[model samples]
Target: MENVAILVDGAFFIKRALHIFGKLTPDELASKLCSYSEKHLARDRKGERNKLYRIFFYDCPPLQNKVFHPYHQQQIDMAKSERSIWRLQFHDELRKKRKMALRLGRIDDINVTWRINYDKIKKLCSGRLKWHDLKEEDFSMDVKQKGVDMRIGIDITSLALKKQVTQIVLISGDSDFVPAAKFARREGIDFILDPMWAPIKEDLYEHIDGLRSTFPKPCNKKKLESSY
Candidate 1:
């Protein structure tokens, strides 16, 4: 029997799931992932079950305070936020799940800088902006996730090269994985991409062996975010 390995972009999945499924607990998230893979991704063309090699979830530890609201100039308390709390809980759940591997990336959270948006800068230059008029999305944050993409790429390549799994199902919408996907496919792995019912580019489609989404597309599809 063929073996399938499920790779999840944890940050992407969490953000997307919260937006679409409305704040599922960690258990719900794990169950959904398992259910989806077993019922959909881990199936052969002949409708046979594939052995689940492992489920790898990649993410970074949440920012450890020190961030601030650019406009308000108030320190953002990540610890007290419900989102942060739930994410930690979710990580714990992943740790406890059978055959689940939680691969964490380092958070480049040492610096807190706000890079102003292009439009906002234009507005500022035109003297059309005031301190009180600024909104959160008017600027970009520089909190980078170090090593996440690299780790994911390495894992995919390793899985393919070592022949650990015949099939790989990647649950991510990020096009950043294109090269890795191509490599996996070249290695004779059945590479599948699950964007959680999100639309992918034509270029991405050409690289993967198949596209599958275990979840149903939202009825309010337009309102759902295209990517995380």
Candidate 2:
């Protein structure tokens, strides 16, 4: 019997689920996720039950400040509420640090004789860097600085090297995982990519052995409400 390990990107999954199914209560969402997992397991090898391995959910806690968009805030709120309900061990990445870096300048003071550099630095300190002040190329510079991809990759590789499980199921749509998937495949482990309720990427199909989407069905409102 092959053991199947499930690695869930909590942030990605929650956002996808909420986007697909309206706003669901924490318990309702957790139940739906479990159901989705069961379906994925049953779909493999003619309903033969695979050994249930540990389910690892990776995500950073919401910024202590609710600075994210409204939808994102809802997702993060649901995740916090669901942690205890689902017995999910939350693994926090440095999301706040990344956010800070994106908003703040990266380089230390470079001595410049130009008045423009001094003026720019003063404006930055005064919180005057508006959207118009930035150039098109600077859009990329606003990306979150934390490397969630690197963290996920390291864990996947470490588990593969340790021979912790026979198969790995990763729940994320981020293409950044392509290399990690390749590495897992090289180790002769089955790499399944489950994008929870997100549109499937055709290019990713070739890399993964199995694909599953966890879209919530039209659930009864009363039942969902009580589960919370």
Candidate 3:
């Protein structure tokens, strides 16, 4: 049986899951993540169930400082905010799961600011709506995660160099991992990409061993299929 390590890009997974599968509770999300990952361990055409080495989840802790919201016209305490509370609970739930390691990065609070949503920005650009028509819901905090990508790269390199796992399944749509994927493949580690049914560029095919999405395909039928 192949030994496999699953690495999850927490933000990407959460965003995609909310869009495709609707809202789920903190515990529900954790359970769903585990269940989805376990599917990769199912027997292959060779009839061998892959053994799980471990699961690495990368994310940034929610911002805990008070920040002014220009659209809402109020100062918000993010530490007590609904999203922050939910994230804290979700992290706690993940800690109790076996074979799961949460690698938390820091949020760039120094440069954090409110930014208009992409949809609203597009509407404004197309003259479909004016800036005055924007509402509080049209704005979201723009936060850049620090150290998350570095941690992911480091983990992948470590796994490959140490010969820890025969395969690495990365659950992310970001192409920043291409270099790491190349290194892992050179080390004889089977690198798999799971974009969660999101469309990927044709150029991304050469870096990985295979592509597979464990979830149902999204409504848009223009996604790139598995490269296996």
Q: Choose the strongest candidate by lDDT.
A: 3
lDDT of 1 by residue, 143-171 (tens): 68899999999999999999999999999
Better of 1 and 3 by lDDT: 3
**What are the runs in model 3 whose C-alpha is more than 4 Å off?**
44-46, 122-128, 220-228
Q: Among all windows of ten consecutive residues in candidate 2, which has the lowest summed lDDT?
A: 96-105
Name the candidate that leads on TM-score: 3
Comparing 1 and 2 by lDDT, which wins?
1
Q: Show the colliding residue pairs in model 2.
A: none
Error of 3 at 211 (Å): 0.3
The lDDT values for all models are: 0.80, 0.57, 0.88
What's the candidate order when arranged by decreasing lDDT? 3, 1, 2
RMSD of candidate 2 to the truth, in angstroms, is 12.6
- Give the C-alpha miss distance for residue 184 in model 3, angstroms: 0.6
